[model samples]
Target: MEADPRWIETPDDGELADRLRQGGEAVRAELKKVIIGQDDVVEQVLTSLFAGGNSLIVGVPGLAKTLLIQTLSEVLDLSFNRIQFTPDLMPSDITGTDIIQEDPDTGQRKLVFMKGPLFANIVLADEINRTPPKTQSALLEAMEEKQVTIQGRTYGLSAPFFVLATQNPIELEGTYPLPEAQLDRFMFQINIDYLPEDEELEVIQRTTTVAGEPPQAILSAEAIAGFQHLVRKVPISESVARYAVQLARRTRPGRDDAPDYVRQYVGYGASVRAAQYLVLGGKARALLRGEVNVSFDDVRSLCAPVFRHRILTNFHAESERVTTDDLVKQLLDDVKPPKSGM
Candidate 1:
């Protein structure tokens, strides 16, 4: 990857850039200990982390979606908590509730706020769709605001907090599809698939044998925060930033510039947050690959993951068996970048 000519000169910029690249590679190397494939999945998830955004992982069973996320927390050496969302789960369960407590000396009855699983640095909401919207929304505030309100009191979550949620797409028996508003909160809806034949065989062989050593932690919570702060310093040309905006804008159904397919199949287009994430994700991705500047290719490569969940599809698309991914793909093809920088 070529560093952008517009890159701002900073002291030890190259050294820090190398550290970021090596740190990313280190995480991937550690994941290889148990996880066999899905390099893209790992990359996207890590990008979201660097961008300070949450992700929704979709996959069928036995794909190691949960395992991958759990391994990530270990590799980062961050505090980890896993919540198995179920149909009967309560909102208070995910965000702890206030309970009555009596003091031994004064005999005074008071309510003590108990913290729940959502307070950790890295939270894995496994099978997020399994819970009702009420419970699912309990996490929405924390994901967005980085704090949970209980009994009218707001509690701050530790910095560098990330919610990596997983959903089993095949089973819809008791699943409550996330609301469109909540869906937009996630930076990317990552789809993980079964491994290749050789990778599958390797997984079986590895699992059948004696358990191996766990992945060693590479970056600490402080180091991750440092990278996150550094990501914001990466710059993109105005043309490229406009290209990212146009890419999100074209997803709208009514706009004259929207493609015929989008007008026909899409009910609503992505919000401005889509563009913001596109740019932010691009910066993080650039740094992850050891590049010092954002490129057009960086924004284009993230279109699917960023737009798929933001664009709301209509009945026409569903009836024709068209997916949101199809809409995003068409958006990328039909929307031409600016002749110069875009």
Candidate 2:
């Protein structure tokens, strides 16, 4: 992967961090022109993108989840594609399919592969939960390997490929629940809450008025890809990395360091991927703040989005109206970071 021609190493940490911070501010300013106010949601999405990871956005309808993704696609100068996942959707519909085609003059037939919407740089898997497990499984390979295989033939996707999926939280009657394994593939499960009163009024006022022009592109596809690689190079202290791992470990019910609430409420804890994403996300967050070194605060701020969907809460907690977010906050309170040094 490092040898890929599209990959770029950061020449200067301070200069790159400053550029990233400036770019982030510009992106946010442009996003505000379209989106009313989901600052945290937008930031998390950008963080995951810079970290070269996928995101699963869960929210109620009419919250502009789709619009947010579309706007992001426009601002990043990425090839955009939106797949409306339905019950009857097939795997071939997403990953493309091979079809027979005849030569124009020779009358000889050969198979031709037609690319699907998933081939784009930014793919919006809208209402992803509406599709069955079989169709949903199609994204697993592309999301993990950045490639798809059909009939034992493989095709590489575009650079900086990202899958930003949305799910309706309130309506689950006809929707198929995403498998735990598939859910874990996402780096962050961002919960988009309703807008505040003032923001909602701004939304209404803006919609009622004439539509403004879309935001201009902030970064080219190659630049975005380069930034993704650069984000990985951000320095992280051993103590901060250890703090991330310790936080993930305490979520397990069987671990000796597990908190009392975790054993009582959690049926299963997060996987090692949780720890990995925590550090990666912290690195990205640090970059957007013009800092090259990830701090413990960066990891702590991302815990809810990184671990909320990964950790499984038991029926006892469900009956008690306890949420995974609450459990994660409790875990944060229970686990303290290394005080002085590594």
Candidate 3:
């Protein structure tokens, strides 16, 4: 990862923290114009954006996953591209390809590289699981290296590139599941569900009328980048860091730190990336709550998304209807709280 030049001279800690909170509030206000009551999903997206990480949104169809990303692009004033991943999709379709073209003046043939939709500032990978692993790997390089290499040449993506991939969980047939490697690249796997009764009613009322209002743009791409830099400056206590690590390590089966329930059910634990995301995501969560310091609550709340995809359950666990979410909750409950003096 390239060093952020904005960090050369750190701004006043207090003032910069306040700016991050204000920016987050502005983003939320803009998204509310179209999105109804998915505050948790919205928060996770905002947190990932500020933490400079990608998100995988899994939900049933028609839950506004695409709309949520579109609204985010408008709010942040970033170039948004949506790619509909299908079974027949190819890697070149997303990473672009070299095409032979005739020069207008000389009438000479030259290979021109046409950029794909992945070059945009914000990418909505719609139905990502519909595509095979080969096509999915195209995004892996971009997500991890923040660059694309084609034909023995590398093209750096725009600064602050974010991929918000959506996958349908209800369908299994004719779908290619994402590999663990690709899945681990995502900072958070957010589960978006249907709206509540009142929220659904509100959505009905709003969409029923033809006069549905469009959201106005709030922050520019540069401004969003600035806010992301600010998130990195949030201070995390030593205890929080250790807690984050322990939380990740304890998910493994038969570990000393693992709860009895976790040891019996979990087949594998989260990777170190989960611990890193826990700290960074907790900091972002704190910033969202208008705090300069990370708190245990931030880490606790982030456990579900951070561990859901990382943990693998055993067949016996699955037979018992045990979910990774349940294991994460149990781990959080089992971990002792920080000392009162600290």
Candidate 4:
């Protein structure tokens, strides 16, 4: 298999950096056992994990989105849970609830907190958009705070908790689109497209040939948490950070720095969180590839996944058949990085 383009040679620092890079390579190696292609999607998913954030995977059905996430969790050795979200799915169903159970010896009853699927280290929220907002809101607390509150009591989730949510973009009927607030919590809006004809043929051949073997675990939960900290420590020069911030700020239609396309096509621009994720995701990307520090290219490379969902297009753009990705691409072309090198 061809290596990911971003994993070029670069000097790494410390034992942790070396481990992070090796771990990444090992993961890709293992994932190839069953997965046919989608290297970019896999990279973004790993970047989100290393950055200690969640991701929303958008794709058409039969793309193996669920299988990809399930395989990832297995290879990472994290506890995995899959929740099939529907309109009737309740908050308590996801977050668990306090149930009154009687003690056999004492004959006493009290509310006991029962852990739900959200308690796992890695949660696959399948068809997340199919659920109502009220039920979806249950994840907000756990996703942001790493804890769930039930019956006036909050319980902390296990460390290295990551949610990989998948939604079928083509299936909008009877679906409750995720609210902006919930969408913002996600670190990336990963878009998965059709694989190459060759790869698709290989996928067909493999599935028809034999029962596939599963990927081996590469990193433990504690190690993953440690690598997450290491990613945060990946330094970036202020100029590069400013460039990322400016890029995100320019997405806003009301901002002075926003380009004419943004003003005409977009209803709203990205938020400060967009800038934050750019830096964070860039840092993780840099670390994975053995880059010593974050770069302007790192920030730019993540623009589509980081800003696409955050930037909301207006009616004019929709009518004109323009997408947020189109606007972001134009924005990238117009924006330039600082002259100074780190």
Best by lDDT: 2
Quantify all predictions' global Cα lDDT against the true fold: 0.89, 0.90, 0.86, 0.89
Model 2 lDDT, residue 338, Cα: 82
lDDT by residue (169-256, candidate 2, tens digit) is 8897999999999999999999999899999999999999899977877877777777887888888999999999999999999998
N/CA/C clash count, model 3: 0
1-342 in candidate 4: lDDT tens per residue? Answer: 222323232344477788788889889889899888999999999999999999999999988899899888878878889999999999999999889999999999988889989999999999999999988889888899999988888899999999999989888899998989999999999999999999999999999886777677777887888888888888889999999989998998897777999999999889899999999999999988988799888999999999989999999999999998998899889998878855
Give each model a TM-score.
0.94, 0.96, 0.94, 0.95
Candidate 2, superposed: residue stretches over 4 Å from native? 1-13
Tell me how many clashing residue pairs each candidate has: 0, 0, 0, 0
lDDT digits (tens) for residues 1-342 of candidate 3: 222223222356676677667767877887898999999999999999989999999999999999999988887777889999999999899989999999999999999999999999999999999999988998999999998889889999997899999999999999999999988999999999888899999999988888556776666667667777877877888998898998888888767767788778878889999999999999889988987788888998999999999998898788999988888877887886587512
Q: Is candidate 2 or candidate 3 better by TM-score?
A: 2
The root-mean-square deviation over C-alpha atoms between each candidate and the true structure, in angstroms, is 4.8, 3.4, 3.7, 4.2
Superior candidate under lDDT, 2 versus 4:
2
Q: What does candidate 1's lDDT look like per residue over 70-179, in tens digits?
A: 88888888899999999999988988888899999999999898889998999999999999989988899999899999878899999899999998888989789999
Native-to-model Cα distance after best TM-score fit, residue 142 in candidate 4, in Å: 1.0
TM-score of 3: 0.94
